[model samples]
Target: MTSYNKVNGKWTAENDYLLNEVLKKKWGFKGFVVSDWGAAHSTAGSAQAGLDLEMPFGEYYNDSLINKALQTGEIKEELIDDKIRRLLRVRFEAGMFGPQEKQTEGIFHSNLHKQIAYEAAVNGIVLLKNESELLPIDTGKVRKIAVIGPNAAFARIGGGGSSKVTPHYSVSPMEGLKNKLGNSVEISYALGAIIKNDVRIIENSFFENYNGKKGLKAQYFGNINCEGEPSYTRTDTEVNYLWYYDAPYWDFHGADDSNYFSVRWTGKIKAPKSGKYKFQVMHNDGARLTINGNVLINLWKDRRKSEIDEAVIYLEKGQVYDIQLDYYNNGGVSEIKLGWEIPDTDLIKEATELAKKSDLAILCIGLSDHFEGEGRDREFLILENQDKLIKEVVKANSNTIVVIISGTPPILETWVDEVPAIVQAWFAGQEGGNAIADILLGNRNPSGKLPCTFYKSQNDSPGFSDYQNDDLQSKYVEGIYVGYRYLDKHKIEARFPFGHGLSYSKFVYGKPQYALNENNKAEVKFTLTNTGISAGAEVAQLYIKPLNSQVERPEKELKAYKKVYLRSGESKEVIFELNQDDFKYYDTNIHDWQIDKSQFQLLIGSSSQDIRQTTTPKSL
Candidate 1:
């Protein structure tokens, strides 16, 4: 047995040993366990338990270690054979070590795949605000359209990490509009603000190969000075490097010796504009930055944690400048970030000029992969500098349509009121541009509803400060009061309630009807009618509320939803069934799910806040 270590005020053992009793035996898990990178700290204990494989590279599951364990009888021979059999079984089932299949040409970028992608993008677009029917732009009357903002030309198809995929081609919002409008409409584009501070070496066109190679050249030294010849040299594909829980894979030494090491990265960056650019470096321990043989930032000392250091420098447009970064890690966690913000004085000027001349300004600005992605949390809930850009663009042209391209609901109190229209365009895939254009041009009716509550600010959330804890202890103190439930229970109003969306056509709902079914389940029925001129889809939401219950519960919980398409003056009936699981709540005293024999309220509406009809139904 291995000794335990104290972490977060609790004694923690290696998961390789803990998982055997918990997952394999207690839970009856037949699947083998694969250890995370560098997670297997022991040889005998881990193998004696249920650990089948060590990922990436095996430090403990080698031949010598297993032989020693087998000779000492710490790990039985059957365990080793069983692990190998499981590995081979999984490999055979996955077809990895089986008969190979031939690849088909053009299958990767087939037309059918592209059409599905386009359909998904258009269907997911949610129309949040359309004041006075400002959308459905008149193509005959509108000749000039100014596509303004940093995201106007930027094609954010997906986020970072594993989700980052290089599509065959991506259509930017500007391109989509142009392709849809054709030669009839003249479109102008302007980057309203420098949304992305710096581009990555692997992705961005602004970064060139440092040593006439593909990526930035990195030289690693064992000592702190980075003197003489480097112990190892490699090319780093990305500049945004973070090595906290684990260290980088190097040949010279093991990860345990990562405490005292130095690295220097040399790269070249091309400036897109001629202005003062802000260079920033976020790092733990010590880091230094230099550009064009000049030391821009020097924070080469041990920092308690991670800190950001920034400096400003003027550069010429189209000229590639030499960039270098020196980083050293001295124990604990390690992280280094190298990025720069482009000068923005000319950005506002260009946007205003384009907006004044155009008939309408389409400001495509919102969060991107840099702000929201895997393993990264947003620092601020509000979209930075977007309010200023919106105000400036709206001032120049009152006929402005603000489109927010983000995965989650962004804070919109700053300039939401000033704009005539707002659209929530989530990280639409390869055909996002065409979908957005279709919605703006009225080629497609927006019907997507908000899945989560859109709060005015981060402070409005019930668990805002308690989201992440450092002590490894998290409590769902809010319980059933999450998202819209929290707002509804506390009588707190959100910027936009959950299940809220707008269509070109108006929808009216009839009184909700409910009854107990033969299966002892509750069935809710309602009718919806499109009372407007255009054909659209309406999402009828059904929420369950307890009229009287012994246990504490939320004001209402959304149980089921149905989206129905209706032509002008068309009506349709929606039916949803709720089972025993829907009415049952966890009873602490009984230690099981329980349902109180009481009257329940059934709600039907377009949104959580816009309940049109409610009726109390008797339970079976």
Candidate 2:
């Protein structure tokens, strides 16, 4: 019932929400929400709901789906009217369409958002483990620095979503840090692990069992050659190969005809900066890399007969080196986690050392190539090693700061309390390194909240294993209750609740004023004032549940929410409108959305379960 994002080209689009909610409701949002992948099918209207433009998807506006929606009455023409009007409102608010500020043509493009992204990254970086003051590597003092690790250079950048923009350009951590340190800090590098697991396989199946269902929309490119040749190609058939692409118009036509093909290639990667480093690597299939133009990765490039097992390398500071690897997947599944450890920044090694000099230790641990950014969701292989690493790191160094960078939530229990601080750096785009550095140096206070929940373990989930492929037969097990709702109803506790995050600053919540008109529906107004030194946005969440109902119910569900930014001592009345629809849920028994006409409880809080204020409905 909620929405999920996807990646297409350079931007992220809302495959689910943007069209159904933003466009369907013609929502007049003052602040624009971003899109996640292939969502241009409904982009214009999305922009109307305060989503001015889709990120990285360039400036494309899908007219076909809009025309279809309008022609079939799937959407009303009035929606277009509202959309244009709402976009104008955003334009005015941004001083683009309004008389407030006459903008010069050149001013249309701004880099301020890039800075904002960096700052946001700094704030979101959760300090998971820090012992022996192993951080704040004063750039001025560190003479020889070794930045090693598959992720040290690899940019987990913004993930695959409609927001995924074919960036006009992008920056990786190694490049950014090298630019930051200059020649003062000598650095070494080693891709001790592989970031992307090359999956190659030769297998196909005929769906004689496939019922008459719409197959994958076909868009054939008919095999373009590497040197501009029309090489071998395959035609179409009912193979159900749902080839995913981000291009606006898939202009390929063909019938399913099987064909054979072969491809090859190679490249090199140099340790842009050199210091002291070592490798820790893994892989299920083939791959190759080179240092000093020597193959760091040496594997047979072919089918499933052999896999690129693993490789290691030592790093030296300020020494320019080269790297090259060859990879190809034959079939089935594959896995890889290639990381490096530089003597200067090796948390794992430092944590285990007996002669550590720093007063506090900061262990920067989280989803490396496994979580966040792209290749594939859940492709980052978040396994039991995560739990083990957390516990071991904290046990080795008590005063540790832990940071997690994942697109989704991971279980937490092994070392939550053993560590002093935790930060959630959710795939912050480019300049990720600077963001981490700034946060560690106290340049910013974190204000980002959990967009999803963190469970204590997978077993705590009712149906984690059967969720992906078991569609019709899949059972919610927990019923209508999800996330905080299910936990609250069953009195089950989560490692971290949704919308939970810590800030260096503090805030206060005033009692909410619930009011209604004769129609027995209205919005509740509340005042949220930030009493901290730094400015930040607060995501005020609204949850509702039936007081007395004839049907079964979960705990409270998030009905509506609003994010507001305010300065210290500045106060604004925040309002949340509650309508009949707000109280309704999909009543499958009646096959319609319905709202129970009875007493209701409203829970307002910094996050789910931790209610700071509550109220009983005065009406409806």
Candidate 3:
């Protein structure tokens, strides 16, 4: 919309060529195309190029602009009418002009939904390691339990950004264990270290009343340098702000859009105790922070949204210091966040001492919304401050269990061997804590399978820099060889293969058999028997491979999978259906998918790296 050679590398939403030729014409898409904020530039070009709706209230497609263009004959009325028709049809379907259903009290926090969520969490948890059958802790004998780590007492219910939601109730792991064990078992908790390093500075209790005045005094200048008198002066409680579009304070005050603008926030901060406080400043364009008129952190420059600049300052107990921050937005997207951190050093020692005395130690450590979320990418896959915490905890107590609560995989090689048991408890929603406690107490047998492979190192997987080229083209170079396929093809062993999961009980698999029906569909049959004391479920995975093919393909591809539950010593034969299209690969030259006329191999396995049976099927 702005220019072809611009940021985001000419995305299809903004590019006229791809939007018209590929989306509307080749794909025959009849749906409305919505432009993102600030994406639409030209009214005629965007409308003709297939944009149907301008999202979040648009500026270019306003009534005046479109009407002027239509009156001037710059664009046909049919084109404008077509866009409106699509929008009105969607609006009508959504019942925008119709009566809406009213919500009942306590419907959002229903107990029925919470139970369903707990069940889902119980099934989704995967046990990565359980050495010497240390799990299912003997609460009767082990009276003293130590729950320690960053997420030990915190309720990590959801990720950040749009996916984040405030649940009616969220039980922390420490609370869950205590409720499960009761007074018979004594439990203690310790937050060894902070989970996220970039904690925001100006929280609810950041500012103090200065001469009976609350919050910080903010002054907005018309120019970037904050020179002369401010255009507007006001007091604000919160410092962190983001003005992507439709500037709230400026637009209402009728401030100039161009020539850039600056804001100065001044306040008094009283330190609770004598210690070193870390202050962080993050901004899209430029910003600077000062304490007592001393320039400590300065990052005033024309830069994109970047990692925050941090500075540590010593403060005395009950002492008040004047704090000032200056921020300027040079157009485009604007963001500013001022945050501070207070170190909790003594907790690590207390946690170690507690672990040394406890019979069993539960280390709840993993990623939070700040680290992995919807709009943000992970800076590092490894657990933060957990590596050192794990080593320290294990050194004090040999009977320790490492419980990782993350939505994505974290590198566990740092202290995997030190701990006796390891459980991967993903973002388990509101009832995650109770679900994790159930698995620990052996109330539920862990049956969840890994949806993706866990690489030993970040280098073993695909590189992010190579993910996008100089031309901004995202090339899937790995192609069919993603996850376990890539690891298997390259002979790079994974820390845990795709679909891998452990259960309290064990299972044995039998040979697989297949027969082609009249419709040329393959019906695969296999038997899985539970061989352990506990009743559990096993995911039976089936992968297909073309042994002799003209085009290069993965070593194998997962075709079908089913979770089969069996009681102890019980066996069940599972059958799956597969058509010819399941084994076909897309030919780029022909622009169509085609099946090969070569011999195909069928593999049955619990995990990608743990195959149980294999068979060669006749070509159709």
Candidate 4:
């Protein structure tokens, strides 16, 4: 599918050089191309450029528009038939034109699929730091385990936007530990910090309707502005709703159109404590809040992105206040949530105290979709208030394990040295909690490797301004010097190098043997032995360094890699076949890939910085 971004200053959907010249002709992609949602710009332009389909109901690629374009000679009828032919060819190759198979019941969400998810989550977890081999917590020695931090109670299944998934069942980190250790070990939990800026949803007990009922009265309108009569009226236990692709009252009245809608909720709120309260509303389009006839927040304007607006007001205990909220959805992905933060509490102190009394502390802290996700970019990589939380928890309980839950790497320079063990558990799937438990309890040896370099700070890499121009253009000034290449070129050390991951068991590599085969392919062979007592998997990476070249190149470039699992005292011979294409570099001057007859240094290792064997081989 064509992406939402542009290539060479032209929209991908309408770029003929990219779609027709490069994708279709040069690469020989026979399948028809589809544009992303709302990505199509012009019917004639996109159709001529090889865009065969427009996603989620077309605005420009409609039948009327296409027919108009063809009639006006802007697009040819032959091109339209070719697009349909490609699509039909793909369907025919998949046997769709043949016999129809009977649909199988209970195929989806089966036990086999669950097992695959569990294995994927287990293998994708990377072990970053294991000081003193403190992980694989000895359940017999540690009686009480304190699970602290914001992400401990809930399972962070995945990031937001299209990546989010709804599993049949999910297990939180706290629940996983209990399920693993059972009653043999006492487990405690405490919220160390509030990572999300928005507060929790207001409880149902705190609200009352006009009839003294236990929920707020909601009135829904079909238009953006609340006008005339209400289309629907209902009682909502809480003012939290994420109507992603459906309008309000979709389930009850089948109003699937989410383009324009508004809702107003009215109730009375009573504070449990007399203190300053911070009220917040997380919405996509527009929202307003009022209490006792005073408008606290009035953001009644169309918003293209999701945002959080807040206000602080003092409320008295035992006194009831009239509360009202108005929300409107201008377009896509509707969401509105009313929440508040009460008086401040010493959460860090409480967590530290619990850690001090426990035998061991497992701190679950990291970024979620709230901090980084689609349509949002984090201002900084360091987790907010989590560095301090880690520092304090480690000081209280020396035996602490830091489990990080994020889709990307986070800066850990502040408290990384103080922590004994650290696990980088990327947004695991439905069985994420159980997978993390497996790694922590030594049921599985971590074999996951970092796909990119982790810099110590943002300054260690190229400045963001270097890549973004004032004319709203992205500049690849670093060229091929990205990730580990940039670090290697600048002689800067990484916090953790690319492809770096630690395992419970260790492996040793023998000297590599290189030879050219009859087909002129470089054949490299080596033996890997599991020296440690425990069984584990090792990801062997092959890198090539140009010993002689006319153009400048990075220190090394990864060509191929393989993951080999070995038992204790077991050895296996690994082979890798490489052709001349693997050593060729893209030459912009010639507008093609070019290879030089030069001797290249072949380095085999577990990580980019940990090469174990080296051999010199000439380019095939």
Candidate 5:
């Protein structure tokens, strides 16, 4: 699919050189190219540039625009036919047209899929820092465990935007620990800090209906205004609804249309504490909030996207104030959330106190979809308020383990020295909780490695200044020096090197042996022995360093890697076959790939900076 980014100042959807020449002709990509939602700019230009499909109802590629473009001889009929053929070829090759097999019942959330998710979460978790081997918590000695942080209770299955999915079930870190330890260990929890600055949703415990129920009385109306008798009435647990593509009470009344609908929620809200409170109403179309018969927010207008309107008011502790929320949906995606920011509580203090009393403290903290995602690029590598949380928690409890749940690397220099152990669990799937528990309890050995170098700060990273460029056009400033290559070239030390990961068991690598075969491929062999008592897997990375090259090159480029698992005291011989293409580099002068007939050094190691053995391969 064509991305939202641009190449050489031209949008990817409209770039012919990228979509057609490089992708289709050079790479021979047989699949049809589809543009990202709203990425297609011109119907004729994009279609001619090999964009076979425009997604999400196609604003530019509509029938009228296409027909007009065709009439003007801009987009040929042959091009359209080719696009259709490519699309159909994929479907036909996938057996979609001939599919007659009956799908297995309960296959959507089958146990087999759940087990696969568990295994993936287990293997993908990277042990970044394990100072003095503080991880693999001794459950027998640690009778009391304190799980602290905002993300401890909720399972962060994935990031937001188009990549988000509704899992059948998810286990949070807190729940996972409880399930793993059972009654043998006593667990306590404290919310250290919230990840986002927005107000949290008011819990259902704070609301009470007229009938003294633990929820608000909701009345759904078919019309835009709640003027007549309601179409449906129910006790809604909360004033939060993401009624996308359907109106309120859609299931009960079968109201297919979401364009015209209104809802009224009547309830009594009790203040948890006596202080000033900020109430927020996030809505898409129109919404209003009234407390004690006084209108707080009157945003009764259409909105293209969901927006939040907040009002601050003072309320006494334990006082029941009458609250009413009126909402109407007049368009696209429908969503409404009534939230509030209560008076400041000593959340950190509470967590510290709990940590001091517990035998072990596990801080689950990291970025969520709100901080980082497809379109949401984080401004800083440091997690907001989490470094302070970790610092404070570690001071209270000497034995602390930090579990980072994120899709990207977060700077841990602030509290990394203080913490004994740290685990990088990157948006683990549905079984993430169980996987984390297994790692902590020593049921599974960690073998995952960092895919990218973790810079100490944003300034130390390559292309740091270019990322902040406001202009639409981005110059290729960094060029080939990216990630570890840039760091290696500049002799900049990283917080954690690429392919860096900790395992309970240690592996020793023997001297590498290499020879050129009759096929002109370099065959390398090495022996790996599990020195530690624990059994684990090791990812052996092979890097190729050019001895003398006409053109400038990186310090070393990763050519091949293999993950080898061995039991304690077990030794295995690992082999890697390197072809001619692996030694070739792109020659910009010739606009093609070329290989230099010079000696090359092969470095084998666990990480980019941890080379164990080196061998020189004969020149071609």
Candidate 6:
């Protein structure tokens, strides 16, 4: 009912193509439909195509089109009544129709949704590698534990964006373990390096000796925004307010390079334990770590790299010295990292002697403000420091199991070899901490899988920048191939592969059954059985690939997926509809979604690469 930009005379009063056949025959999505802001051009056609509610509100939606559509008999008069009733039903069902109790933050603390989120987080964690049977820390074997790293103190609950959420609580791995172990373990923390820095932090108090020209720790300073010419203000304050962004900005890209964040911060570290102690630290933009003030590993500098920096510091029994680092970023994005590997061998040896004590070294890592802060174009040609955290921790302490908390998948190649387990804790709202804790304590079986592809290297991606301008316009140059589709289509392997997940328990799949109906849509049914000792959930993925195509297409696309929970030794049938849309593709030349009646291959599997059987669809 509302009209914004008619987009020249080329855009008709209605785009009937998408409404009648596509929404009906393809998506079968006839419900109380909502008109996207300014999407309503002709009320008669849109209503006939099933337009229900014209939102949000505008002059075009008022009376003229409504009366015209009714007078012309273009839309059933009863359709309006049905739509209103359906909207009311949904509103009441959501508990948003009237007032009852004032909703508070962390209101879902004890909600089943939170439990589901926690379970999803644990399942999303991918156990890339487990060498020497080094995991399952057996916290009872180590007495003295060293928890080091930026993440040890402040956990990254989510990135910065619409997906970003202020959780009711976020449980740092440090806090989670403390809750898990209680009084039996002794833990210490070390912040080996500062987060990204700039000249802004230098003007603040703590930096009397910590300027960018540093003597105390590592330091680097530059403009906050790296894009255009920076605005200068000599009368304001320090060297540059030109750098870093003011708070409350939005980043749909990766991170913004404009704004004053932290200054290059480097800290001289001290180890509390004498035995084998562990240290973990990660930074975006620029970072360098030195033990006894020597370069252990340096992965910093801002060149659009979004990998997480990490390291395991080995200490000489109770040997305490300075750990220094230097860093700065031109705003764009932010990242926070820190974790502990494990106690030194001698410490482990000593701990074993001390009443059989052992502590878990859980390195929780993910995207940070610097890596995913505020900007519209956050895509990077290089994965940043957060990408390195898991490798660093696993290399330092075989006992380390990293838990990644973010809204989306971060590239996972460099560190997969070192980690025995991974959990995708997608910004779990306010109860982040409690949810994370619940998963690590084995209270929940991870049942989540990759929602998107995790490229092994930036080189493997098709469009990782150098595409799209600032006009809020970007093309699907890859055509219908997105996510797993592109990976399989191009035969480019990913770090963890799509639809891959692991649980404490195991599952087995039986042959799949293909059932045809008179309509083009069909159903594929398969049996899943839990064969492990513990109850768990398994996510099954269905991939559809054109046997041969009139035009080039992705090797396979994710058509349907389902997650089934089964107790130990339980089995259930998982059925999914193979609708006509499953066989559809966006033809750029035609500017429409098309489906070929040619042969299609349906591969049902545990992961994208683990197809157990293949089937074909019946054409209408």
Clashes of 6: 85
What is the clash count of model 5? 0
Model 6 alpha-carbon drift over 4 Å, by segment: 1-128, 131-136, 140-145, 162-164, 197-360, 380-395, 465-475, 517-521, 585-595, 616-620
Candidate 5 all-Cα RMSD:
3.9
Please, what are the lDDT tens digits per residue for candidate 1 over residues 1-620? 22233333322324543566656676776666776555566777777657788765778888898898899889898988888887887788889987789877777589888999999998889898999787978888999999987667767776654355556567889889988999999998877775654332222356786556556788887766667787788777445655553344334452337657778988887888899988778787888888999998888888856667888899999999888899988875566777666776566788899999999999998876667776566644666666788999999999999988887777888888899999988889889999999999999999999888889878778777576678746566677788888898888888888999999999999887788778877888888899999899999988888888877888888889998999999999888999878888888785568976666888888899999889886554
**Which lDDT tens digits does candidate 3 get at residues 566-610?**
998999999988997888888889767898777889999889999
Candidate 3 regions exceeding 4 Å error are 1-10, 14-31, 36-49, 64-99, 198-344, 465-473, 518-520
Q: How high is the CA lDDT of each candidate model?
A: 0.78, 0.51, 0.79, 0.85, 0.85, 0.56
**For model 1, the run of ten residues with the poorest summed lDDT:** 1-10
RMSD each, Å: 8.1, 14.2, 7.8, 5.1, 3.9, 12.9
Query: How many steric overlaps are in each model, in order?
Result: 0, 102, 3, 0, 0, 85
TM-scores for every predicted model: 0.72, 0.58, 0.74, 0.83, 0.87, 0.58
Off by over 4 Å in 5: 100-102, 201-344, 517-520
Error of 2 at 584 (Å): 1.7
The regions of model 1 sitting more than 4 angstroms off are: 1-101, 199-345, 467-472, 518-520, 589-591
Encode model 5's per-residue lDDT on 330-363: one tens digit a residue: 8656778888878877778989999999999999
| Better model by lDDT: candidate 4 vs candidate 6 | 4
1-620: candidate 6 lDDT, tens digit per residue: 32332332322235445544565457765345666565676566656655667766843445787776678787676867876776787788777867878757555666776777655555555544345544334455766655544454555565554345444445666666677768876865433223332000212221223334322442222343222322321111112111223321222222334333334334433444455544444445655556676676676556454454445555654444664444455464444333344443332223223212224456555545555654444553233444443344445555665666555666666667656655666655434555565565566656667666667776666675426558634454665666667777678877767777667677888888887756656888889999988798888888887876787777887788887999999999999887777777777797788987567778888788778777775642
